[model samples]
Target: MRKIKLKSISIAIVLIALMLGSCSDEILVEEPRGVFTPDFFTTELGVQGGLTYLYQSTRSIYGFAYFLNLGETGTDEYAAAQSADNNFHDLDLAGQGNLSSTSGFSIGRVWGTSFPAINTASGIIENAEAVNLDNSLIAEAKFFRAFYYFLLVQTYGGVPLDLGGGELKFNNSVVRTSVRNTVPEVYTKAIFPDLEDAVNDLPDNPRLTGTVTKNVARLFLAKAYLTYGWWLENPNSIPTYPEASRTDPDGNSPSYYFQGAYDVAMDGINNPGPYRLLDCFYDVHVATNDRHEEMLFYSDRTEESQIYNEADLGWSGTDGGGPNTAVWMVTPNYTTITVDGVSAVQREAAQSYGRPWTRMAPTINVFTETFAEKDLDSRYDATFVSSYRGNWDKGGDTTPTITAANGMEIAPGDAVISFLDDYDPSVNYVNGGNLGGGEIAGRSDYVINLNEINRRFYPGLWKLGTYRTDNAGGLGSPNGALTRPFPIAKFSELYLVAAEAAVKGASGSMSARDLVNVIRARAGKWCYDNGENEPRVEDNSAAMVAATPAVVDIDFILAERSREYFGEGYRWYDLVRTQKWTEYASSYEIGGNSASDHSPTVTNRTIQPYHYLRPIPRSQIDDMDMSQAEKDAYQNPGYQ
Candidate 1:
């Protein structure tokens, strides 16, 4: 776990840039002050600044990862601020025939940013060697270059392999690279080589204490391989081009690429990298800092002992989180969460200031039935709640005032639902608020389904639904509510990914029992009979809450993943990867806000192959200069 020394690195980069550029007459004569030219930035010091820029790119909030949350066919975060009136009404959840190509929010951004990073990395790879650079530093840049490409291929399928680095000739025309490498070829030629080289050149430990290290590179490799395995194993259903004239000369199809992806994953994991899964989800807390085993590789947020104050906090506004009003509004009312050990109720006041983005809400189809069993897993509790003992607390109650990004005030209110008694039905209604009332109240409709006594409110409460006085006023005013809560990151996901890979690797022949049980054991609760009765499986009913000590299976693992990784953003991907998009929402009859409610019958069965890969963005098609039919054949062949 290398730590980044921000202050020292910052100073070193500037000084090095100056020293290296000091002899440049052009720089001295042209502006005497401004630094320019390759000569001025060719040294280690100059490279540090460039490297810092690369590091900063990894931490951006608007890339594929962030937009993935919104575009995934589950929750509709766009509808929260009342902004989703036109384009996204149908994206609430994936229904039969409900798929659309318009929601590819970050696809274009991913395409653009990845190339800049690729060029930056290529520059480092080429020039660093000329300067006799440290092998470790060079390895870091190569790893990033590969990482960017990995993202590109995964989302856009075969891409133009830009191996020429950044030295394009002045007369070079910008032509689409004709050799659109297959997914397998890309991994073998670009990703794997870069990672292997990185592992060899990079030190096991980084020179800076908290920067990207050998282990981080290894993790990136692991992810690349894992995703490659996924793509290889689950290739495109119908070939993008079926006719001889339509197919590329390489004869590669979607399925061929996906299978290669899986093989890459096996290679990465078998390498015995330093990263390992954390045994205890709750105890492995590295609040405000990076975790060693839990996060195999991550961009460091800490600066000069102060964790980079970036807002990665999923929900809630305090604990230095950003505005996340979506979760605050949609979480069911009866589902009470505790912060630390205290009732999340107590800390509602402080979550208002710097309220997290209310973006990214949970789909009722996916999240409501979660944690239905009383003896449900503790990991689920830790993953979603700020606290567990009938409240939300993390150390002492350090609840802060909730405020909007615009510096306006807001208040945190009571839990949308109260679980004080045995899953009481009335908690939902009682927790529902009048959205058209106070200064803060007027901002929301606070819609409630009066028909169902135990239903989650529409536009669910943000930041775990813990109420606070500070947010009693309107959003963004000083009088806002303080509703910050803990964000879930490295909890059960490692287990889930491991479980998924194991199950898929079985290829439906081998049983993946161990993988599932390991998760259930951590789930840590089971249904039990009363003192008069024995704890038998048949004796348990939906009302009976107890811990689960049963053997794990594939079906049960999916359910466990739902319960454990609810708000942390795993459900959508899980469903897509398993080819079970319909099942994600269709498994449960209920739709909308009520637990007892159900949508009109809609056919939701096994995933259509086209559903696996989103339609290439419409903008991408418009970007091409080819004929209408040729462009259609290339980007949207089915339509062609």
Candidate 2:
């Protein structure tokens, strides 16, 4: 995998504008400046460019690869394939016994990208009055600044605070070494204040999907408050800083922010804004429906907004990463075999599901119970691809010839999986009976169960696959390039957030189960009443959890989130904030599927108290030049 480099960025030169007189009226026109300078911010274009860069900086944060590594993998919902190379490969287990520390490379990317963005946003905020544009632009800048800071502070508790643009010189001087702020101070001084003002300043509706809106700021603000509230209750956190809840300015109990989080989430839910859950859940991820009501904000990947060029195959000049989708979520590397006289060569993921490096796999927690129910939950079938076209050729030709040796012509939507070889190693001696009795004994039903998919042929999450696009011209089609938009905040999550806040003592117009029941009922709303609603004759128990019961709680909500937001990159944060890492989480064998010889079953994943926060990058610790005492004081609490 390619790594993104983190290098310090200096605010570059002033844009020089040339004045020219118009021929007709002798009107004076102010030309735009090429270089960026402190004075240029006084002009409209400079402020716009600065704000644009602030959003662009985040492209790396939501990149398919980055989010998988940072946010999703090694959690209860998902795990990486067993590539057997480095400590990073298996996130669920520790390299030896301890969870892995932040790689300097990844941490550098975090510090290097986010801090500079903060500096730029600060530069914009400080110069807001000087600029002639609307305060909204400056307000947008504040949101981004708070946004970057919040991400950093959550990962590495109380990072060094540098808000303004320009140089901050550091020497070996003891007093000169910047002292880190308390966790509360970082929020109150930096994250809270900025987002508070931003919510007031930004408009209710943003001009673009990627741009921040008032509702957007409030959503994050609620999340920040919730995080702060939860941290107060954590016993393993807060190394030396004074307990925040004891001296909180709010004068409320420790969970004050929980209420605050709940309140803001309600405001968002009740707000008569454009954001709402789409009726058809499948429409949420398709390219054409990118403008749906579910989108609160998304990382822009269209040609118009692509800042990092994926088209630059050479990866020259700029730190290149193309506009991307979350295709890396559930694709497995599978070769082809002829079954039932139908020959389907395994297609390139880029063509079908988009190139999957087999980065991560959906665990049994998701498959069996979380996303169970073939007849009730339409999401199960809508999200996974059980069939692929066997073009019988890959010579760059528009059409490939298929013969009887290639078997019957399988439609694009035909069954891709057909065997239920569970290969439990313990139970399997050679006999078969796991299938649905008629569809091939123990054969995986691509629609209801994943029995057809063996170790190598893991059922690919059809959500990320652009398989819908393959219909027009087939595998070698000209359209549906792998690079697509990745959803960051969906209105659906806001509903879940509202449900959680209500459970945690926020205002709840509806019960937690009622709120979650909306999602559960919606999952089954699209499916037709078929015999598969319940388990089949031979099928012992596949849809046990798939039954839509009205029972609900925090555990129920979290499970539903696993089902709904699986691989959308929210698992790790969910586990951390709730402190439920050990409750029901499971370990698994990765790399290949259950049948693969290469796959190894890994167990005893350690989710410890120290892991509540990630260590600051070693590079930053070295750069700070702190003594043993100072280092202990400055670094995150539990790291070496």
lDDT per model, in order? Answer: 0.40, 0.54
Per-residue lDDT tens digits for candidate 2, residues 1-640, read: 1111122333432222232221312311223233455564566666667776665566566753455555665676666553322323534554432343355223455666676677667667766677665777778888988888898777766655532212221111122244555677778778988899888898877655457788888889988888777676663453334224434555555468878887777777788376776655556654556656777776654433122333322111213333344454356553344434334444542334444445456655455566655555666655655444344344233233322212333333333433222323222212111111123333332211243223344556655554322343444422233445566777776667767766776665766655666666566544221122232222212243345355556787787777777666678788777777666564643334443332334544666565656666655555554477875665566566
Please report the candidate that would top lDDT against the real structure.
2
Minimum summed lDDT over a 10-residue window in model 2 is located at 165-174
RMSD of 1: 11.6
On a 0 to 1 TM-score scale, where does candidate 1 land against the true structure? 0.61
Model 1 lDDT at residue 515: 42
Q: Candidate 1's residue-wise lDDT over 95-122, tens digit each? A: 3224344443433545545555555566
- List where candidate 2 sits over 4 angstroms from the true fold: 1-40, 96-107, 163-177, 235-247, 303-326, 335-343, 346-352, 389-413, 418-456, 466-481, 527-551, 586-602
